[model samples]
Target: MCAEALALLRQQEPWFVSLAILGALYVAAVAYRLLHTSGLALCLRGPKDLRRRYGAWAVVTGPTSGIGRSMALELARRGLNLVLVGRDPGALQDIAGTASDTHGVLTKTVQFDFSLVSTPQGEEAMGRLRQAVERLEVGVLVNNAGVATPHATYLHEADAEAWVRMIRVNLWAVTEVTAAVLPGMVERGRGAVVNIGSGAAEALPSYPLYSVYAATKRYVSQFSRSLCVEYRGKGIDVQCQAPLYVDTKMVTNMVTRGGLLSRLIMPTSDAYAGAAARWIGHRRPVCMPNLGHRLQWCLCHFVPDRALAAHRLRENLRQRAVFQLLRSSSGEGIGGRR
Candidate 1:
């Protein structure tokens, strides 16, 4: 029996050794590719003509705060004149002033509530934006305005009106705004449209409250890709920047009492802005800011649904525990129940 076992082990040893070698080579190749194919490299290799063609004028929606504000600032730094759009006239003025003073670039402010646009009032607001763009020799459009409601247990239990509002803001506004500007871009034969999207488009399950928001963002991603395909030959670039939880007022409020999963995944608005600038400059179709986010999304595409759900449940519980600990340290009770 012992002799037979030794023979079996000897036969399997060569096969095991070959498998190990093959795995090592595969890992080395992947590592090499990662080190070489960075975001910066992609940007550097993009069309030099793109920069020369886009000119100075750019239109950015939701420029008062978060990633939109950052993108507007970044573009200004690159010498692009801006048409800054937002809800509050005062906030828009402040941002426009800052950009003008700091970047020494021309800035225009258009105040319109994206949430109110389905009504006559909304149409009026969009009219203001359209008029503002027509006067400016705008060459780039950043479709960045969006909103998400607080988390609810289930779709039926959620506020239907609020969900519809999210859809209108997150998806409809993008479509309308893009449509407004696209003909001019297409006729000009050179332009770029950068659409801001959420990582939830990958269908991550932790933020059950954001189901409608996620679905809307998925539309943004898919539509952006399709638009790119349609216009690629016409010299129009449509790109999507799908970032994870950004450090902004909206995210801060969402995760203020949120679970541990939120803490682990949340990134700063600055990160999103920087990455998006790179994506916009390069005209990449899709850009996920961080490597961890990229990995999670890639895995989501390949993992089994049941296994993914189990992992998400565990992550949610872990996030909840961390939130509880932070609350307790601040002399608050668990579950934020007080």
Candidate 2:
């Protein structure tokens, strides 16, 4: 076996050398990015640098809960004022007040429902949203408001209303919100745009049951990349962060029932948001800021697509079972998507 392997290696010596060189370059590039965007990099920057680099004010949607809320607080902690957007007026107000009290940063609330985005009135609302922010020196825009399927459903059997809402929140909101903020950033010649996506979109092979949600996330990744290219030299940075599960309400059910591995894999929303914030000035078009998530992203590239698909299918089935059990035990119906 050794003799035959040696003979084959000699025959493909040039090919092997080329592969080795490519692999080395790939490793070097990844290492550089990892180090540059790591938590250590964040430590090197002063709070004043964040305010200066991204601007004085940051806009965050879905700022009432989950990763969105955590990210908003992170920005406030960095000494940036905040524009908090969400459907709930009271919730938005509460967060705004908290940010003001805790971080001593200015905060404003914008009440808007992404669910109605497809309606004419919703378009007008979005227009107003854009108009409202166009005058502000908005430095950072966090397009974090999004909806995922409540549970994995086959595309053929997916609920139409759910589909529309998910699309409106996940895809349309990103476009509208970014459009709302981009022009101001361009005018000022400096800004950062963070589009929050999911691992399902960029890391997994194919999300079989959550097809539409995954597709929307993929669109976010692609959109962020293209926008970055368009604005790269112009001084605006666009980034899509495709993260794995975070300890948010969206995954509360899974987190409660999942094993140790699942819990370990999903960082708390605060943890994930802090890591993501560190990557803002890294200039990378896409980021999976969590070290564990980065490893998963790399492994998914090497794994066979079909095998990954099978594994996802199995996981979806398990999640479905859990949902069914919860529904049966509690009189409450399915939970809303985040």
Candidate 3:
């Protein structure tokens, strides 16, 4: 009976066999992604569990606003005392107060501008930052601080000072701060490092107008992956959290103009933070907190790179036009007032 069944199958069709094999492979790939790659595998741990796994304290840079602020608050909720780092002392104090009051967790603030890297002031700030994290038992270091171009433009057209500042904040800060905190984590033999990257790093083919920003984020993802490989058995989980977008002032008008679909797809910072929290101790080298972003990443691979690049270029061109119009209108209004 088995021989007869095999004979009948072999007699049937070659295309059918090929299609069946392809279908099986696709199913397996999907299962692996769901079980290991995506956040679906992440099991959210409570404060007690988190403390046991990571440590008592977590340090978050850019904690004054946006995703940084939300992640800091969420960490506090999970019972980890916080060391909040940001440029605004007032904003830092406010978040510290809220975290302490709401979660009954101790909080400390470190106010320093990352864009000052080329100056004596930057050196002084780095000294202070080093001192801030030295004595504390820092379990998790959230390298969330970053900057982007104010207006989309080619490298030549971009403001020279702003371009340099973006590099200092986005790339320099991550490297310096991580180097400062990593030694302690290594010595302790258990910790987590969460580098907040952008989907610009890998989700699309190429980011044209935002070249510097994309390059910096690519650095972050690579840095995280290499660190994870180097420190795996030592009990340190270095992972990059790269999300597409969240409603935050950093994005300005682009995020605000989105309708209901945008609101749902690109979540608010707080919502994104909550979802991101699930991967705190997750072992993956990267995490896309939003499901929409995960799907976008997967879909981008199916399209041609040139097509994706073309689409991005067109979108960026539209944005540049709109921004120029707004600037000109504002200038005209000011002249009229004069």
Candidate 4:
């Protein structure tokens, strides 16, 4: 049977060659993506001389927890001094210490509540941040602060205050901070700004349940692309990193902690930060850093908007059910729609 099949394949020489070529190309592409996602390319080349390429000081907002904390550490590990900005002075100091704050010129802290932007108190905080960052050779800025509706909830049912908070942290704060930092970079002729975005907006064709969160993230993606174009000539690298289902406090409703599937698909904040950090000065203006996420992104593109939206609705409903069951049993510990 094997000999007969081999003989038949040989007779169709052109088709066989074409199929073989296509298979080879497919394998090669997959291999390339795997290498890219694993961050092996960065390892092989070694760390960039970040101090030379960008500057000595890097500013990170919301550096107290989640992706922000991990990113601050990664940058510190790579030899960039840090200015850690967040809501809690104590938490900011705590994260800074973990990043080796005792050492000379390693870290500083700014206490600013991004949710208060444009208020009188917010202006004072912004002025303090400006003072902290402007005099330094601030090379890289990571706008990582963000918020979501507490859980899966309809826009109508969602708290109006929550929408304002999301817009402030996700969109307005990013704009204000970038404005504060960009001038010094332009004067010095180089810097990199990294904005953390959500896959809710970038990967999915439509995200109905969490409409405001998705819209804010969409703004992040657009802002990053437009800023990159506007500043490319001035030696600045602006990037928006769109991550999907990172195992952070924010995604408690979406991922079951420590489950096999969650372990495979959802990168912990530290794991994501390590991979995401390597791509900071890279050329891609907007990108998904995880291999699984990149695959998910490709799949989402082929799916129609209506179907994806329906699927999201279903998932939201399912999660809400889980929340109810757990909450009833455990007395409000379970995450639920706000």
Q: Where does candidate 2 clash, by residue pair?
A: none
Question: Candidates' TM-scores?
Answer: 0.76, 0.86, 0.87, 0.84
What does each candidate score in C-alpha RMSD?
A: 8.3, 5.9, 4.8, 5.1
Q: Give the C-alpha miss distance for residue 91 in model 1, angstroms.
A: 0.7
- Local accuracy of candidate 1 as per-residue lDDT tens digits, 1-338: 99996676677878886787699899999887665434546555643433367756889998888878888887887788999888889988998999999999999888877777688988998888888777556678998888865343357765678777777888988998898888777777878998888776654654453467778888999999899889989888888878776677555433443455553466566666656665664556777755446656766768777777776556545654564565668885322100
Q: What is the lDDT of residue 21 in candidate 2?
A: 68
Model 2, residue 206: what's the lDDT?
88
Clashing pairs in 1: 117-122, 259-319, 259-320, 260-319, 260-320, 261-319
The best candidate by TM-score is: 3
Ten contiguous residues minimizing lDDT sum, candidate 4 = 329-338
> What lDDT score goes with residue 243 in model 1?
76
Q: Local distance difference test, per candidate?
A: 0.73, 0.84, 0.82, 0.84
By TM-score, how accurate is candidate 4?
A: 0.84
